[model samples]
Target: MTISGSCFCGAVTYKIEGKLRDARSCHCSMCRKAFSAQASAYALVEQSEFRWLSGEKLLTNYESKHGAGLQFCSKCGSTLCGTYKGMIHGVTLGCVDGNPDIALDRHIFVGSKALWETVPEGVPQYEELPPENA
Candidate 1:
């Protein structure tokens, strides 16, 4: 299956081929700040299956730290996606155009979660990153 998405102003667009992994909500402080929400939802896609469909030049990359960077649309400042070590590509759930046939898998970085925010019921919650097998 192919799933497409774009930034708020349509300045940046992307296409993901094949199946997307189950989504996860991240409660890390950086994620909260980047998304301006209690958490950020994302689905990981294999590097080879992800492609920039348009506005590649309008996408500005902010390297938050070593080996990781967030890509957003320069025109509207929409957080489009992120790259980790240039391997796995993480697509923001909000920017997706339609259903991506995926479900929430778990929540991570709960230790940094906002005090007023409560995790959704029944979803697995982890203080930090989940185990490799999770």
Candidate 2:
């Protein structure tokens, strides 16, 4: 299955060629500030299976002091994706075109979550990134 998405102004578009998995919500302070939301939802995709169909030139990347870099549409300022020191890309689900046929498996960085934010019940919560085996 393939999942597709674009920025608010449709300037940037992307396609995920394979199945998406390990979806999660991040309540980290950096995420909240970067996304301008209480939390950010994302799904993991292999770099080989992901493609930027358009607007590659319009993507502007910002690397925080913590070494976390995010890519967003320069025209619309929409958060598109993020990359760590790995081959996987974390695609923000909010910009996705449709239902990704996945569910949030866990909540990460809850320890740094906003005081006013309340995470949903029944979902696994972690004070930081999940264990490698999780």
Candidate 3:
């Protein structure tokens, strides 16, 4: 399935040629600050399947000391996607143009989550990452 998304101002657009997986909401402080939200909802995609569709020059990136790279639109400051060591890590679900047929299957880092942020019932929660085999 091909997925499309863009920044708020349409300054940066992207296409993912394959399906997304490992959907999750990250509640760690770094994620909260990176997304400017209580948490960040995202799904991982292969770098080979991801590409910029337009306005690539308008994308500004920031790489954390831990090597997590985030891409934002310089025009609207919208968080578009995440990276690791210059490779595509995942796309922010909020930026997707339409429903991506996926939902957060895991709520991670609840131990470091904001006190006011309550994860809804039924979704799996973890203080950190789930067991690698989970």
Highest TM-score: give the candidate number: 3
Kindly list the per-residue Cα lDDT of model 3 for residues 26-92, writing each as its tens digit: 9999999988899999999989999999999998989988798899999999999999988889999
The ten-residue window of minimal lDDT in model 2 covers 81-90
Clashing pairs in 2: none
Ranking by lDDT, best first? 3, 2, 1
Most accurate candidate by lDDT: 3
TM-score-based ranking? 3, 1, 2
Tens digit per residue, CA lDDT, model 1, 1-134: 99999999887889988878869999999899988999999988888998988999998777755676788889999998878765547899899989999998999999899999999889998999898735
Model 2 misplaced regions, further than 4 Å: 85-88
TM-score of each: 0.93, 0.93, 0.95
Regions of candidate 1 where Cα sits further than 4 Å from its true position = 86-88
Give the per-residue lDDT of model 2 (tens digit) for 1-134.
88999999998999998878899999998899999999999988888999999998999888766667789999999999988743337899999999889999999999999999989999999999888844
RMSD of each: 1.6, 1.7, 1.4
Per-residue lDDT, model 1, residue 96, is 91
Candidate 3 error regions (>4 Å): none
Each candidate structure's count of clashing pairs: 0, 0, 0
